[model samples]
Target: MTGRQVIVRRARAEDIPGLVASSAGLFAEDGGTRDSSVNVDWPREHGARSFAAALDDPARLVLAVEHDGQVVGHLMGSLTGPTAKRPVTSATLVSIHVRPGHRRARAGDRLVEEFLDWARRQGAEHAEVTAYSANTDAVRFYERSGFAAMTVTLRQPL
Candidate 1:
């Protein structure tokens, strides 16, 4: 697993399928308690079309981690607003997914690195990502990549 073997690059529309597939299993494992089939349809169900639209937007950044000519991981983020008091620009990391086989091999790190680089290039003063509270591994991954726990989002279904 030499770092040189893996390449990180901006994602194209063609890469969406792979990114969606990579996330399906993780998404199911993390949530989707009511119906198992809900997990498999997450890509399209969660607005893949809108995601494609955003990916093509200049205001957004999407990157993929490729190994041996296959996209094994991907990360996406977008600029928000000067929502904070410090004249900050908010960037939300919409997604980060690595193929199961590529976990723990720095693929995730590379994706996050590219994401942060894109955010900084866009003049973002603050970056934020939401992770499932039950997903400890994801929390650790973000923390290891220099992210901190800012606030908790409590939800209640009506």
Candidate 2:
């Protein structure tokens, strides 16, 4: 459906199933293809508990985007306070996903916009997210959303 209206709002307990589904989709499309070690089944097996606790945490933001009264996307974020070595508060955009059919419709953008707004309000001095270096689409999306490279992590197989 082109030009359809989509709603972005804080996730409620009832949205957990949708959140889990979208997260599973992310794992399958992102980590599943990018890395062989990722457990694609984790969302289906453990997401309900994790997401439920997140819904109750004030330092966490779980957002769901719905179109035609069905969840089409989800975003998960967390706040981090200052530490001895790191004195600045921060927010991490933990995970995000929009159904393939719902992509290019600004659903992901809407989710990120809400997440950044929430992070700012929570006294976060910085916001960050990590996308696999090989995931060009995700990296481009994050760059377009105003994120730039802060660090590069090189890895070697054991």
For TM-score, the strongest prediction is 2
lDDT tens string, model 2, 1-158?
A: 45357788899998899989999999999999999999999999999998999999999999998888888889999998799889988999999999988886788888888999999999999899999999999999999999999999988999
Best by lDDT: 2
lDDT digits (tens) for residues 8-56 of candidate 1: 8887788777666656655655556433445556665774675588777
Candidate 1: give the clashing pairs.
none
Could you tell me how far off, in angstroms, the CA of residue 133 lies in candidate 2 after the best superposition?
0.7
The global C-alpha lDDT for each of the candidates, from Candidate 1 onward, is 0.77, 0.91
Clashes of 1: 0
Which 10-residue window of candidate 2 scores lowest in summed lDDT? 1-10
Q: Where does candidate 1 stray beyond 4 Å?
A: 33-40, 83-87, 156-158
